[model samples]
Target chain A: MKPILRIGSGAGFSGDRLEPAVALAEHGALDYLVLECLAERTIALAQLRRVADPAAGFDPLLVRRLRPLLPFIKARGLRLVTNMGAANPLAAARRVVELARELGTPVRVAAVTGDEVLELLDPAQPTLETGQPLAHYPQLVSANAYLGVEALLPALASDAQVIISGRVADPSLFLAPVVHHFGWSLDDHERLGQGTVMGHLLECAGQLTGGYYADPGVKDVPGLAWLGFPWADVDAEGGMELGKIPASGGIISLATVKEQLLYEVTDPAAYVTPDVVADFCGVRLRATGPDRVRVEGGRGSPRSSTLKVSVGYRAGFVGEGEMSYGGHNCVARGRLAGEIVRERLAGEFAQLQVDLLGVSSLHGEERGAQSRPYEVRLRVAGRAEDAARAARVGEEVEALYTNGPAGGGGARKSVVEQVGIVSCLLPRDRVRTGVEMFGP
Target chain B: MKHKLFHLAHSRAGDKGDTSILSLIAYRPEDYPRLCAQVSAQAVKALLAGLVQGEVRRFELPDLEALLFVCEHALATGVTTSLRLDAHGKSLSSALLEMEIEMDRDIDTRIPTHAHAHTPTQGS
Candidate 1:
């Protein structure tokens, strides 16, 4: 076993930049580089793409992200682990193999499957929201369970240079390498939890290194545009020392670490993952030097017998239109423009939200007091039964440029189908995850 | 003086389903107690008022000098369907941090909240 394991973060979400991740592999000197490019709805949407074309269903930005890092990872002998496969791991693996061939590099990739639990879902499976039976929904686009590290053990055991997964837990991707590097058992909850903590911190890439942490004077971070990706050095005992790419601008203070530590986490004492139920409350974090923090004192309990599944179904469609109104009384004109669209789509729309950009947009009426600016953008969005009706919300908003409000211009409209998600818990015995390696 | 929670502490907001959890961590180790006492779930609920449709649950992590608050139904719907700009409620931390809290003594305003000299301690 290696004395120290260094894992670097690539992209936080699917659309995250490729620059920071490239910096981490080229400069950070990583043993393993992970990109967590999947979210709850992202895969469901990807599944929709797969329905249209068999080869589709993976992350749209996967090729661009992998292309830049492949040359570096290949030269340095760095391993790439990611959940960018989204809905189709095999197809994604095939695409990656093609990309490697074009780059004239030899690479090994692992494509794991069986996160989809749709086959096992029954009428009895109740959703967490209304606790309604799964059968109640006639249309379900996708249902994938959050798998654990065990599913990745085979891939890590092989000589795979890249490990790809569909919908495993974000932390599990990073934790898998730590387990393989240190030879940690699946039941080693304490050390697993420590490794899991490190995974959670780096899972969001630039978020930990001040991309999402900056607030100008309040929380100033230099070179946020070139914000470096973060990585953690894990010792045999599971002690994690966190830092970012060299010469990359961003701070790694106790505050930045603490924010990331608690990001997307519900309970500090029971941050549940498939590998372990980590307790972040007990985790200790301290600054070691500039752009570095020593993180330890992580603890955990056994994981739950059941794994959570994110199920996506057809909700409806969303239609939106926006028009910018400038000069005197812009807010009033914007509000008036919204009223015009509302009146036009009256009975057709199930729900409508009117927002005046300069004064009160996100909060709507709840944003009681308003600010009067010379320019205001009027945005109107609605829910409709079909895409055609949803598209009308945008049509009526565009019509306002000529008919409804004075000094109105820059009309933009779009109609998009909404993807709704419901969550359920499935027993461990029900899932059958397996991994296979592919190379060119 | 009425000081904003943003002035004395740092927070991170996250969403699960329709719930949004905000973890509030104090700048100084000694300031944790006041935050625990003052920044209650009720206060957060009151601060966000109409935005939160359900109950607010708070968990104190004295070990990290932090209090994590889970605000249910804060997102109009899950992010996939939410029409708001801040779909995941990423800005909710700033909204909660904007809350006014009464303080008796003046904190050294020179040091930023994310700045170091942080004394690490362990207690639950």
Candidate 2:
């Protein structure tokens, strides 16, 4: 049995930087490199693109992301796993095969499917969030179950060098390889839970390495510009030490780890994922050395019987416009401009939101007594059923230069179709996962 | 004396649907109890009265010296659906740190007073 296995995170989210990931593949000496690129809304957006073109649903940067790292992967015999496939793993796997051939570094690839369960969805079912019947929303676009380690095990068992998937839980992307390499039983919840702790810590790439911890005077993290991605060395028992490349920029301290440990996580005792009900309350982090921390003591219970399925629907369109005003009473001019747009779009939009940026934007209308700023940006946004009506909100804001506010400049407007996501539980037995292998 | 939580603690905000999860971690282990006592869910909900529309639940991790605040109806909505510029509510952590709390005079010396500390050298 391999005493220890090293896994490195390549990309935290879809738009994460490429250089940090490249740094990992070239120097990190990793056994497996997992790139977690899917977010809650990414797959739903990809589904919309798939409807327009069957092969266009994968991550748009898949090729660019893989082009530079394929050589390192091939040379090092390093296994790669990612959810960059988004809505189309098969096409993404095919692109990997083609890219490998073009680079003269042929590699076996596996595409894991079965996360898409739109056909099994019943519109009459109730959403977990609102308890409203699915049929209540007429514009349903996609339904994808969050698959677990079970979905990727078959691919890992195969000789494929790269595994592409859609909608696999983020932690499962890292935990699957640990379970595979350690030969741990699926029922071994303790190890699975501890393995998940490592996954969760490393999942956000730079976040673990102090990308998000810098607060100038309070919590300063150096070398953020060249912030390095993180990697963890895990033993058979799930004990691990997390670190980044020595030459890379970023700090890995107990403070950084503790912050990420609870990020996006609500309950400390029962952090639910597809594979296991991870209990991070018992987890511990120690600063072993500079840019290195040892993590242990995470516990887990049996897996949940149901899988979370993200259902996406067309909510509506958001129309927004921004115009900046400077020099003498800009906050007043900005507020006046916002009032002008609100008046013009009265009764036309379902929701109208107005803000004088730099004055009272982020926290809503709760500005305490403070000195008035010399400049402010007026922002007017509204939601409507159709694009034309939404566009009118921005048109009114843009008209401020010629129609209402004086000295208005840098006017900007955007109208985008919003995708709404709701979650519901599906019976675990309902998901039938399979893997298709391809080679160059 | 009343001191801003920013002096003794640091926080990170996360979102799930309309709920925003903020992790408040004490810089020193000795300050955990003070954080638990002062940074109650009610206090957090009241501090973010304008943003959080629903209940605020606080989960404590004594082992980690941290407090997790889950604020419902906090994002205006979720990231994709919310019209707010900072839809993810990433800045809420900083906002929460702005909250003031009564701190003991003796404990004030424990907090870092410098504006910057040199990045620790390797193997320090």
Candidate 3:
């Protein structure tokens, strides 16, 4: 009714940091602040944290940031939403409510649950990539379904002003408020499509607005003190404008927008979600100027039967070791050492996938096996059964010091086992989005 | 006629093992309850043979004054990697429009027009 205003809000530069987030919200330029704190590994970390200190888990630092900014959010009548509750939204909400009461701000907090499928994990669900039942490994660390904006609608409608969620789809935070306040239905396919595209753009905050853009020459876009969070203005006609805190740092350009559009969405036309099958290709990106890109003309259809689920598993143990090279044959020397390790692994084991990072020449390509580099670190990944051999692989890399390359003396670094076989399972049942409205 | 045809599409599109659903038709705001009822009737568990968990989402598009029920989790059937209907599959909208209401052809054509008539002449 109020010309549906939406924005993308996130922390900048800091990894899972929330101090900056609270500072941004304190500025009061956004209607809804969506924080993305979930990464493949962060979820795993949260899972581990919850095990030891249930209350200590989650990125509480962001909640601390929100504590100082709650007064401003309530004063400005802005609402906040975030997935900082990577493992526990309820516990996270309890802490927020406590903080709110402490500050004398009667802000209500709602926790959207039923996303964590870990409870229902059949240990039996089949992996989409591998036909094996997820239950094959019982020690599954973490399993969650990416909930859409629908799940946040009820809490948002309660006029809580601040909504905390766990494992929500990264883009849903940006789109949920728009859909709820504007009273948009799931079938408003086109508008939902447009809104989703906008969410995808803002989900990463500065990532698109020049935070990680491909532009090599562009520098400093001002207002760096308070980085911008993403938001949008949607109308009755299904039109949306993607903008952020006007005074925030960073630049939004066609290149940035295009790169963000392709970030996780592989297919432009068949961008699938529980709500709708969005058409990202139909989006027309125009550089209206410096930090502004106008997106329009996107389309969407009713979603097909299946929800595209993101399943993360401990596929296998992964380890990497780096060795430096020098002299005229620096490049050749690195390759020779890598070859020696590969040759040893091949002779000893089977199906060892090795990758040379930092030194790949064709690193620019999204999916490629060949690359040229001065120094190469061999990376290997396989089943836990290969852990012994993998550890041997590491030993072999260190052994290369005696058998291969010029700088083999000090170059031989011990192999560090970074990742292990993780059992990940997705339950058949998950919580669908529900709405709860409050007010006269 | 539209509902019957959509039901057929829903049956064909429903897969096994994967949680997914087929939306035979998009609904309007006024049609939300109806859509909800229809989705509720098509229990996600029933369609997946009680092996998978699923739900039906009624996507409301106030802009177009339309609603669509997305049968999510129908992919529980693990029918396919992609749930999008093949281009050759009958278009839901066209099928609804082309359906001959043997009982009221002329009246059916007037449905959309009458719905539009209820819209306010001025913006709220």
Per-candidate TM-scores read: 0.96, 0.96, 0.65
Instruction: Judging by TM-score against the true structure, name the best candidate.
Output: 2
Model 3 CAPRI quality: incorrect
After superposition, which runs of candidate 2 have C-alpha atoms over 4 Å from their true positions? A368-371, B106-124
Write the residue-wise lDDT of candidate 3 on A412-435 in tens digits. 323222222222333223446443
By lDDT: ranked, best first: 2, 1, 3
Q: Each prediction's DockQ?
A: 0.52, 0.45, 0.02
Question: Which candidate wins on DockQ?
Answer: 1
Clashing pairs in 2: none
lDDT of 3: 0.53
Q: Candidate 2, A378: how far from true, in Å?
A: 1.0
- The model with the greater DockQ, 1 or 3, is 1
**What is candidate 2's CA lDDT for residue A289?**
65
Q: Chain B alone, model 1: TM-score?
A: 0.90
lDDT of 1 by residue, A1-440 (tens): 67999999988999888888888888888999999999889999999999999999999998999998889876887999999999999999888988988999868889999999888888687899769988777689999999989999899889888889999999999999999888999889999889889889988888888878777666788888778889999998898888886698887778788888888887878989899999887787777777878888888999999999999998889888989988887778788888878887887876788888766665446543546678888888888768998898899988886799788899999988988899999999999998877775
- For residues A79-148, could you state the per-residue lDDT of candidate 2 as single tens digits? 9999998999999999999999999999999999999998998888999877899999789898999999
Q: In candidate 2, how many Å is residue B28 off?
A: 1.5
TM-score comparison, 2 vs 3, better candidate: 2
- Runs in model 3 with CA error above 4 Å? A11-24, A64-68, A100-106, A119-125, A135-139, A217-229, A245-247, A305-312, A343-358, A361-404, A408-440, B1-124
